[model samples]
Target: MKALSESHYWATNKKKSKETDQLSPFKVLVRKEVSDHVHSWRFILLLALVLLTFFASLYISMSNIRASFSNVNDPDHAFLYLKLLSATDGSMPPFHILMSFLAPLLGITMGFDAINSEQNSGSLTRLLAQPVYRDNILLAKFYSAMLIIATLFISLTLLMIGGGLFFTGVRIESQEFLRIIGFSVLTIVYVGFYLSLSIMLSVAFRHASTSALTALGIWLFFTVFYPILVNLAIRAFLPDAAYLTQGEKLAYNELIMDIMRVAPGQLYSDGATTMLMPSIRSLGPMSMEQLSGAIPSPLPLRESLIIVWPQLTGLLAGSIAFFALSYYLFMRREIRS
Candidate 1:
């Protein structure tokens, strides 16, 4: 009896080992997530919308740039590349602003149902039973969505550069190219924060719709009304400050600026504005004392980076914090499906 039991135990252990080693678990999970996103109707529609808006904005901007190329007198037109990407016909926002608004939709759509949909369909239980480690499922979803966003950003960057060259008949300068690259990278980081935020929502809520609406609510608040609300609240607190001295006024403005930076959109827009409009030096309100003898000149790439590094750091921190929170919550979540 002892000999028979020993043989059976070894056989069961070997079978389990084989099951766990059947395939590359991470790749399997990533492939599954990528395939689902690629084939989904929502992704298709979202891609169509992004492309339509971007190319239309690009066309409008190119026309404006051509019309003004003859009048260019900024010594450097230091903003030639940025102008190509952002200068509109005064009828619409720039291409980059349109992108900023549209990108959160991509994040919310891809991530809002990450876990709950699987649970609803009764597939979550089966996925957990697979040979892959449990954490691979969550990581795979994030990495797959990140990969899609990165590819989209890169393609758009190339399209912008190509369009600029073809329309203007001039090669992009090395410095301009680097600045554009930096802008694209920062935009990705900004969008990634939303992606991670939506994923955390999915992990927290049991219903995908709930998570999606919540994510969209947060997005709209930041993009549309957050600053207005902040300004109003500041005034409410300082209702009698309209007659304040110049120094007091400057201090009040600085206080509001710091508060506005709490929103990711504000940080990104401020940073992008500075990088694109090289003439912008101070993010905060500057009195003459602060700007004494400051010439109106375009900043170098290094200087722009130094100015925006804090914003970049904030974006990176937000992305990592949201993802870490999601992971922690997932580890503690009960697998009921």
Candidate 2:
């Protein structure tokens, strides 16, 4: 009777697992990863950091905007909400810039231990022994990280919009609100590029520490050193920059900007700049001929989309390519050790 009871227990568990698999094992894996991230101390620390920057920037912006309004009329403040975000009067970096810098950290934190840690602990092979598919594991990992980022970004954006409405006393245009939404969504995508690359490293490297250090190295180089290198390259290409005519100078600067866009950080900053400040009419330094007769006005949503579409696509493409490469590597990797 005891032997029959054990057989029955195993049979029941097998049936339940089969049903669960049919229901989509990926969903179960995603839920587990999401729950782990939400509860982890690492996530709590990142959340606190995000909130610190979010509120500091928002409060400073409110004070600045209120001060600006002390000397202005009411109707004109309608289109001035963006000034609260973009034009920091020596208090703190703009909300967008702060996010641009810290957002990558969140991605890195979530993804750098995604795969290698499990492998290092010897649970990776056991996990594969389960009913879950291999693709489901990796896909769940990436998607869960993306979902967390999207939630954080959306919440922060709504918080900013609410704070601006209540404290900034500026009338936000409908178009401006839509643009802000688009900007928040694009920021998540930009962060995902880093998240995907970091996960790829996690899969490729044996040690979680090594993968994390590699990711941080890439981030530091791109964020800190790449721009300087790009500038030097521009100067190298233009040895006599001082002797160039204004037209030549503008052309060279545009070339420099185009080359810098190859870096994901630059692409994101350019997109964020264009989204947050619609008054920016051009990415490159504008010649007088181009600026002549140009009315200083905020562009419509459609025009801004057209401007930043390339950057958006680039971020998306980089993320997908890195994910595919990671998937390939993870599949080829053996756990027989």
Candidate 3:
């Protein structure tokens, strides 16, 4: 009887301890992940690359704006040039474009080896031996990657804003500042999408290098090659479609182009245009010229948001869905060599 009672007591204690561990396992995991990331050279390289690219692009853009100002005789042209320099809209200078591309690469670099490295080093087994839950491992790595990406973004944004103030001698309005913040948020979401993708690939592959390369390949496909491929496919499938009259055939061609714009880069380009140019209305079904005739006026911010909301929601939803699938797969995967 005493033996059975002692066994029951020990089992109860073990369960309680596990419950306690589960409650705070992610905290320790996050701390360890942050420490590991800070010590890595990749983090430093990513920061350096982002800063250097930003400054270089900013200098070129400012120089071009200054040259335009000097060459223009009309007062209106000067005012227009100044407005372009001061505006934060979709016509984002080269610096913004550079950062958007760089941000995803940075995210991939930070997360591509997160899980596989631990597995390769045999640390994963030891870590799992602890009372920590498996979900904590994934959550901690994700949060750490996000923190690094956010810090890089904030640092670069401040530098750009400071440079704008120093060179342009214009104070940004509160509303414009808010717009910049909104752009940053979208940029972060873009980065997060890639980071989750990298994590998923990291778990899917055995070698860290393979995982990273796979992520890069996907990035290139989506960002660069995918659009070209899509265009070719469309052209092949719809040869002579563009030469068709501006009636039903032209309408059909436009429909095909709209469907193609579902790709992330095209979607983002359209969304950015709407945000940056008050003159832009609907970007999916109709061109700016067409929309202008229908409204004959600039769209309000609310209307602009409504127009692009579908693309934003779709991209965000796709990212979340992909990550959820990855999480489910990782949780169920066997840890065999």
What is the lDDT of every predicted structure here?
0.85, 0.84, 0.70
Pairs in steric clash, model 1: none
Error of 3 at 159 (Å): 3.0
Identify the runs in model 3 with alpha carbons over 4 angstroms from their true place: 1-23, 66-93, 247-250, 285-298
Show where candidate 2 strays beyond 4 Å: 1-22, 68-77, 168-171
Error of 2 at 197 (Å): 0.5
TM-score of each: 0.89, 0.88, 0.79
TM-score of 1: 0.89
**Among all candidates shown, the one with the greatest TM-score:** 1
**All candidates in order of lDDT, best leading:** 1, 2, 3
Task: Tell me the tens digit of each residue's lDDT in model 1 across 92-206.
Answer: 8987787778877888899999988898898998988877666788899999999988898889989899888777778888878888888888888888999999999999999
lDDT, model 1, position 136: 87
State the lDDT of candidate 3 residue by residue for 191-213, as single tens digits: 78788888899888889999999
Off by over 4 Å in 1: 1-23, 72-78
The lDDT leader among the candidates is 1
